[model samples]
Target: MEINKFIDHTILKATATEADIIELCKEAREYEFFSVCVNSGYVPLAKKQLSNSKVKVCAVVGFPLGAMSTEAKVFEAEQALKDGAEEIDMVINIGELKSKNLKKVEDEIAAIKNVIGDKVLKVIIETCYLTPQEIVIASELAVNAKADYVKTSTGFGTDGAKMENIKLMKKAVNGSAKIKASGGIKNLDTALSYIEAGVERIGTSSGVSIVKELKG
Candidate 1:
């Protein structure tokens, strides 16, 4: 397999600077990875830097913490698209989901998807904060809301994606939507394991290393 194509080369740290994003785009182009994932604020810069290449730009909304209001996340997702983000990775409201406010959680996801229509929407369910049952519920909710992908974690969470969770998500989506395993995936073996388990995308800061390892 061309592992690089399955990777979303990412740098979402708060401390990530302009230089960092530039380097990210450069590496993405060099490696021919699928896309460069960045904060919404850097979407324009990333878009500009990657203008000449095939590497798409992905922006994160609601980020590590999914406590923001739905309107806020929608605006962020919209602006990111205007700024040239080809895909949006949004975090779902964990608090609302835990509170059993399933409609609110699903509506929030739908609100963003409505605006981004046709642009890929990947809902970050932050699997670390949820139970096995909650993981299944959250995955189903994203699919119900028409999200293109149900993502595992934010990497800022206490834990990241696990094989068991992937299994749960796969069964949860039930072929309605795809899965993206992010956070803590840092090596060729771990990435390939998720792919072997049927994840369509891999989000990580170690894309270059993983691709290099594959080449070796």
Candidate 2:
């Protein structure tokens, strides 16, 4: 399969520089990745670098920690879109979800979606921090909130996406939304395994390496 299309070439490290984002867009164009995921601060640069390319600019909202207020997340998402982000990967309020405040979690996602309109919204459930039941509940909440995808991990969590979590997310979304398996997808085999497990997207910093492996 042409796996590059399924990849969201990502670089979300705390120390990422402007040069790093430029190179990311360059590599994304070269590899024809589906998108280049970056921090919100670099959205304009990524958008400029990728202006004439099919590779989209995706911005992360609430980032590694989703403890921010819903207003903050919504504003972040709206500004990212204005800065030219075509897709948004937002972290949910994990604390609320754990507290069984499902409505709060659902409203937070819905509020951001309301501002973005037709722009794509991917909810990062950070599966590593959740139990099986929590994963299911989060997935359902995302679906109900009109999220386009239920993403696994932040790649900043204790662990990234696992096959088991992918399966659970898939069953939970039940076709209500797509699945994006990020974190720990370092090679071709693991990437494909997530796809086979029903993930429609792969978020990783190793997209170039994975494609190189595919070529070899």
Best by lDDT: 1
* Candidate 2 C-alpha RMSD relative to the actual structure: 0.6
How far off is residue 117 in model 1, in Å? 0.2
Worst 10 residues of 1 by lDDT: 207-216
lDDT of each: 0.96, 0.95
Off by over 4 Å in 1: none
Per-residue C-alpha lDDT of model 1 across residues 1-216, encoded as one tens digit per residue:
899999999999989999999999999999999999999999999999999899999999999898999999999999999999999999999999999999999999999999999999999999999999999999999999999999999999999999999999999999999999999999999999999999999999999999989989
Question: Could you tell me which residue pairs clash in candidate 2?
Answer: none
Candidate 2: clashing residue pairs, number: 0
| Model 1, residue pairs in steric clash | none
lDDT per residue (tens digit) for residues 1-216 in model 2: 899999999999999999999999999999999999999999999999998899999999999899999989999999999999999999999999999999999999999999999999999999989999999999999999999999999999899998888899899999999999999889999998888888899999999999999999
Candidate 2: Cα lDDT at 188: 98
| Model 2 ranges with Cα > 4 A deviation | none
Weakest ten-residue segment in model 2 by summed lDDT: 190-199
